[model samples]
Target: MESIINTKILVVMTILALSTGLGSCKIVQFIFGDSLSDVGNNKYLSKSLANANLPWYGIDFGNGMPNGRFTNGRTVADIIGDKMGLPRPPAFLDPSLTEDIILENGVNYASGGGGILNDTGNLFIQKFSLDKQIELFQGTQELIRSKIGAKAAEKFFNGSNYVVALGSNDFINNYLLPVYRDSWTYTDSSFVAYLMDTLGGQLKLLYNLGARQVTVFGLGPMGCIPLQRVLSTTGDCQEKTNNLALSFNRAGQKLVNDLSKSLKNSSIKFGDAYEVVAGVINDPAKFGFNNSDSPCCSFGQIRPALTCIPASTLCEDRSKYVFWDEYHPSDKANEMIANEIIRKLGFLYVNGTNTPPPAPAPTHAHAHAPSPGS
Candidate 1:
């Protein structure tokens, strides 16, 4: 009787081990960054700067309800969520949601007007610093672990992908803004190094906390933002701003490379977001974008502080424009950018084995879906 009982216990243990191993194959995508990657986490936090609660923000999303996204419709995070076989990530602040939401589809900790440094947006007291955002992400993970087991948590982290899109605000809000410029005393190189080191340290922290895959975006061409264009003397891109962005991208790439070498078990991927976005800005015609300098919204000769309300004149065709407002890109442009990053992810993570399958032929309902070539 004792021998038979021991045999049953061994069988149960073996089955449990196999089940755990199989469950690890499921992927969970954890996204972190600024407005570009932010879906609606900012809306959950008590802050007036949050756009997820405003109208016209989700005009193109069918629901016509704002969910904290900065665009007229879905942002890149939504597209990436769909591609990863998960439902759109809910705002971390949605009062109705529970830990199950994150355990199933992951969570977003990104916020608008955020930066790597603490003092990036002092005026917006509600905005989260990059470090704070990471801390939130870790807290979410801890919640998941408590709900599930450590093995399950490891599987979720190991199979998941992380997407980060930021750095624009550091230039526009922190460095260029008169308030920060007057308060902080750092040269261009010094500032760049400080920001990069902080960002790099955060990335390492995420990995140490159990992130297996990560994609860090470099800064886009800051000089071409509608806000910057309006602020420039000749209504042209500011060369100094563009140069600063280039330096940041260069440093970001090096940091990603170093992290990849230092980490033993995980693969950290760096997306050339700088080049991808800069190409669209520099040669809009090549990417089916018509206007790259100014946005499709109302133009201000000095500051672009004008509102782009629904009553305002929207471009006849938003798909042709790269930017939808002073700072955010249109859904069409976001789709293109997301497709580019997806292709890059397939190349880097899949060992070039399985390319993203050709996007299905579009029907009228899904006309905005990316093409196979994308």
Candidate 2:
């Protein structure tokens, strides 16, 4: 495990070296996912209800103000970028974005409420779906070609890093919503299978588009999120939801491995978000946190205000809280999660020196779902 992690570090160190005048390799990041990964695209979705362009959100970022992130500070995506020495990819909808900027800094297509399936975030009404994100990426590919020519564009994209942080919203907003037919149309495992099949196709599309080094983040402990906990009378993590997430993550790790092998010259890594975040929630103090159940910024009596508005009550010290709101983590929690992700994945080379060999895939592909009572 350490060897693989070291290989990852080596890969990123190559980029860090380049960034510091040791080399001229251009390394930039492309980010995609739901709100947890969103930098500011949600702000551009004028009609979307699920947004974080409000008070207390991004309260610790660059200028200590909301910058379109859902949490009180940087999202996990932003923290990961910071850890890798790569500039945080600007939101794809940023009006000032240019083709040159993309070639230099890449772009973030992650928006609040985005999901793998096009229909997953329908209630949001104006969010990007994974397909839409890919479509925009394709458009970015064309935009760059117009500026730097096809060969140069291909080289840029091939060497750039791709970060895909999806799936959580697909379950949280769609499959679990009775308003959506998916909840009724498929059983838990079958739904996960459907998501995996779609994600497999999506990864293939990215490979075809010239992504060689990619890291796909798995869903964290969805059942343990504040929103899920509030659903239980005892305020415990929902076992069924947690089981569903475990099943999906198991499949996701397998998919990442299969794609790494099947796609020539590609190295895809799965970020084990579930275990790492679960560890934090299970024992917050072990990770410098004191509270993992209640959200730091909230307004409702039950906790998880859906959104943290100016009217919400704020925690005395966000650093002690695990969750920022109902759905996202506090900045401190994000940082911890980010560090763990980097430690585990080992490498991300938006533009680097060498590609490491694919790490061994996990042997287990499915977690046993608990029977009726147990």
Q: What TM-score does candidate 1 reach?
A: 0.83
My TM-score estimates for the predictions, one after another, are 0.83, 0.86
Instruction: Give one digit per residue, the lDDT tens place, for model 2 in 120-146.
Output: 888988999999999999999888888
**Candidate 1 lDDT over residue span 1-374, tens digit each:** 99999999999987765444234354557777777767776776675463545544555665545557777666876765565564455656667657766755667778877888877866666777788878888888788788767877777777777877778788888888768862368787888898888888888898888887888876677888887888888988888898999999898888988989988877787666567888888899998878887766543343474335443445656677788778888787777777787787673333124444332211222234222123
Clashing pairs in 2: 8-346, 27-351, 161-350
Candidate 1 vs. truth: CA RMSD? 5.8
Candidate 2 runs further than 4 Å off: 1-24, 300-303, 348-374
How high a TM-score does candidate 2 get?
0.86
- Please state every model's RMSD to the true fold in angstroms: 5.8, 12.0
Reference-based lDDT, each prediction: 0.71, 0.83
Off by over 4 Å in 1: 1-24, 50-52, 181-184, 299-303, 345-374
